[model samples]
Target: MTFTPVTPSDIAPGTTRFVQHEGAAFLVVRDGDGRVHALDGLCSHALLPLAGARVRRGHVICPHHGARFDITTGAAKGPPAHCGVSHYPAQEKDGMIELDLNP
Candidate 1:
């Protein structure tokens, strides 16, 4: 399946927005490079919403347990969160950012 574009630039570079598609809530993380990436958006460790994660040191830091994840690849970088997140492919076209959730 394909991921949808559901946000704008006013939300800030590191800000995350929660989206519901097909009854599933996914988190979209926008990095400093102006690229948008999609992921499960929830922490695998404590099932906390990753959107609440703070952007620091090039990683999304989970607020629940301080779990950090790579925004691009959704890879967990430290303890309290061993399971990595799901990643979606994203691209920009015509001044809009779109994502492919299947990737």
Candidate 2:
């Protein structure tokens, strides 16, 4: 697995940030527990962008249409998004956010 390093300060705790690696878009989220997650940056229901999404209770709520997805498994947990987004492996190490988009 190839892990790309992202500046940890780019994203704050309890918030989501949109990022791109190689040619793929991803959402880097830090939940209330300070755990980091990497998920596909698009909402499955409408293919809408998930940038600036709200992270609550280990889930990322879609800014549009109120779809919710699990941060760890990418499972769609709410309406308007039956299909889940892709969840990539992510970790915080060496004071950086590392993610594997191809994993």
Query: Which 10 consecutive positions of candidate 2 have the poorest summed lDDT?
Result: 4-13
TM-score to native of every candidate shown: 0.81, 0.89
| Tens digits of per-residue lDDT for model 1, 27-87 | 7777787667777767888887765767776688887889878888889998888978887
Instruction: Name the runs in model 2 displaced over 4 angstroms.
Output: 7-10
Tens digit of lDDT per residue, candidate 2, span 22-56? Answer: 77778999888777889998899999889878988
Full-model lDDT, candidate 1: 0.73
User: Model 1: runs farther than 4 Å from truth?
Assistant: 93-96
Note the Cα lDDT for every prediction shown: 0.73, 0.87
TM-score result, candidate 2: 0.89
Candidate 1 has its poorest 10 consecutive residues by lDDT at 3-12
